[model samples]
Target: MNQDEDAAPVEMLASLCEARGWQYEFVGDDELTTEIQGSWATYQLRAVWRSEDHVLQLICLPDIRVPDDKKAQMYEVLALVNEQLWLGHFDVWSNGMVLLYRHAMMLGDDGLLSVAQAQSAIETAVEECDRFYPAFQFILWGDKSPADALASALVDAAGEA
Candidate 1:
């Protein structure tokens, strides 16, 4: 492996974060954490590079809460939401109050996570969270059904006036 590929993935992630001027810190030996500010919300981004498993996991927390009464419908809404996602899926914590987006990929023989891959993972996560944040809000506050919430979220306005 070349020097870049040979470098520990976590170090590379730290480099990437630094180059991008993202505020992040080493949460653990293998984890880097940051926050992504998107149009809809600020998301917590965590990158965990598992050397033993050759896996890189990216998690984005949208920082929304699902109350007990809303959890069931929120899950249903998430089902519909997940179906439309091209990468990663939204999940709730065991406490049923926190919603996070997670996507993981295996490193190839070189065990490298390229900057492009990292960027795409982050962009996808933030975009999806921004796109679907309202749907989650709809279910949480609008009293909309899963289908209705999804529909409300996905509908587009056509006007240039």
Candidate 2:
């Protein structure tokens, strides 16, 4: 796929969300950027989005020169998240490997449980993982396991928030 081309699954998801009255927007571009966390450091935070109750995000880097198999694994991890979780009421935020899970726990503009909250929950999740583990490694070598690990991490982080 072209660095600028979004995966087909994401496009389909976006269409589905739109059909359901949710707005799907993609953010960011194919610009080279530094990986603030992880070995094999340096990547691009390619895209982001807002769904009805979730924040959608994508990042792709054709550089940093990792093995192709590893990159495919990382892509799988992202695909799994979008398929199983992101299409729901759970609000999400992401910048590539760093996915922030929040919402449903905050006070609304009217002081009730708001649909949006401080981004700390998601931020802390990514920070904690980045501090203790290697994001690039996960993406490079993380097969199906990475998906599970990420899902657990997000759930734990949201609970903390």
Candidate 3:
């Protein structure tokens, strides 16, 4: 099968689960279920609606399970990079939830942090990625590193605060 075909399962599953109030959980490629969490902070994805009072395990990509809710403004950010970054498929476990790191960073593109919390959140996310997403690296602001143009944008955003 081609890349598209391999990637289809995760995308379709995510879309279906999202439509039915089901959340995605990232587990390794196996039968047993495991809980995945961020390496940096106490961040975990949460299901808006519990599936039978139990979290569902989904086997797909690491970044596939980012929370769909919270920070209404972040949707624009996520949508902007969907093509470049989120094109791959991931496995999600059903019993896992995402934790929103209160003190995470937000690396922006303007070489200035557009938001103060961006840095902490970014750090948290990076750590989370490191822990659960070793194969997949975390890129902020289009750059391939922890500190880059996106970090600056995050600073700029925080300056407004």
Candidate 4:
């Protein structure tokens, strides 16, 4: 699609969320916030459209806090988790308590953000957050090392029937 024919990412995302019956709100012309409910936690995701740069940034904040004392160790766990992740990386706010997972996609020259693409991005963020949340819990509450925490979290025991 040509640039003029491209649909705005914000509009596409909003429509996708509405069709899915997900709650979302527009923080600005180019920014939106939505929530995803997971088995472990509810994640708040914010999407920002950068028209000038042709990029969409998705940030996910799970409903958990890293204690101040645990922030250093959390960073270590995040580094290990990020290494294994293909899309997003874990990061802590400067306050050292708020944890976030972030991912970004290039909009390409056409700037056409498809419904499938938006759904995929949202699913990825929610899945990643749910997958790594237990590791962070292990680090903060179980006194597990970064490596051990990640290992435990990543172990998949479910088998095919």
Candidate 5:
């Protein structure tokens, strides 16, 4: 196939998800939603194929609700985590409760996103979301500083091994 040829269609992405044993539903012609089970919580992942813009977007929403008082701390921790991430970044809703991790692929320049690329994007979102979830919990419930929460979250990973 020509390198500039359009990548696989949305249907192919759905098939890939199914083959991987993921439960998903099509939200629209260009969007698919799947639920991923994480160590701490179940995450809702949504993939959108923007054919016009030639981008594939992946977003993961963890089962977390940041309290009003913790919004600032949550943003601080998110900033720290975002800095460490190679792809995707954490974002908070204006309501200060909803948190989501988002990543995008420019299909126009990169060509169609292969199955591996799609899977990698999904995995990366879930992995990063799982890693930083506890930090948000700490900030919202434990009242820990952003730095402290992040440190504790990272240290906790070491203990998991």
Candidate 6:
């Protein structure tokens, strides 16, 4: 793990999930899936360990769904929500029906994932998804403007301290 080499970071994530008592199951040799219950909603999180690139991607799909009639507003909300985050940005899936938050951690030359690295990626996904669930909801169902939705959610972009 000292440099670019075969890495089993997905195993590391499994260990983390087990240690935290969060139920998760392996998808394959390189990926895993789990649900993280957040304050706003429970989210499905998938972690894919990209061996060649030495990266682990955590994609979090919240319970929010964008109806066809609300796609315009949802697009606006996507802009507002993504601009307010440091770790990840929100995006709609190819189906154009589901919204997801995506964040990635580069394992660097070592291709190793530390506990903090794994924890950060997982926490970032859940936290961002939870934080903006209401904003998406406001846009999708409440007939609220993106600005109003973000304002109501008290969301502002994070800057480094």
Taking the tens digit of each residue's C-alpha lDDT, what string does model 2 give over 82-132? Answer: 454432211123234333222222222332111122123233333433432
Predicted candidate 1, C-alpha RMSD: 3.1
The global C-alpha lDDT for each of the candidates, from Candidate 1 onward, is: 0.83, 0.36, 0.31, 0.84, 0.81, 0.81
Output the lDDT of residue 47, model 3.
17
| lDDT score of residue 42 within candidate 5 | 90
Instruction: List, residue by residue over 1-161, the lDDT tens digit for candidate 3.
Output: 22232122223334333544544553432112212344433224321212233222222223433344422223333333232232222222344532121221122232222122322323333443333232222332132333332344444434653
2 or 3, greater by lDDT: 2
Candidate 6: give the clashing pairs: none
Q: Over 4 Å off in model 3, which ranges?
A: 1-31, 36-38, 41-71, 86-161
Measured against the true structure, the TM-scores of the candidates, in listed sequence, are 0.88, 0.27, 0.23, 0.90, 0.89, 0.88
Off by over 4 Å in 2: 1-67, 84-137, 141-144
Candidate 1: stretches off by over 4 Å: 1-7, 156-161
1-161 per-residue lDDT for model 5 (tens digits): 33333456566567767777988899988888989888889999888888878888888999677777777888899999888889989998776468999988887554467666666787888889888888888898888999999999989977886
Q: Give candidate 5 regions above 4 Å deviation.
A: 1-9, 109-111
lDDT of 5: 0.81
TM-score, structure 5 vs. true:
0.89
Angstrom error of the Cα, residue 91, model 5: value is 0.5
Model 5 residue 15 CA deviation in Å: 1.5
- Itemize residue pairs with steric clashes in candidate 1: none
Per-residue error at 159 for model 3, in Å? Answer: 21
Q: Write the per-residue lDDT of candidate 4 for residues 1-161, one digit (tens) a residue.
A: 33233368888888877877899999989999998787698889899999889999999999678887888789899888889889878898777478999998998887768777887999999888888888988998999999988888877312212
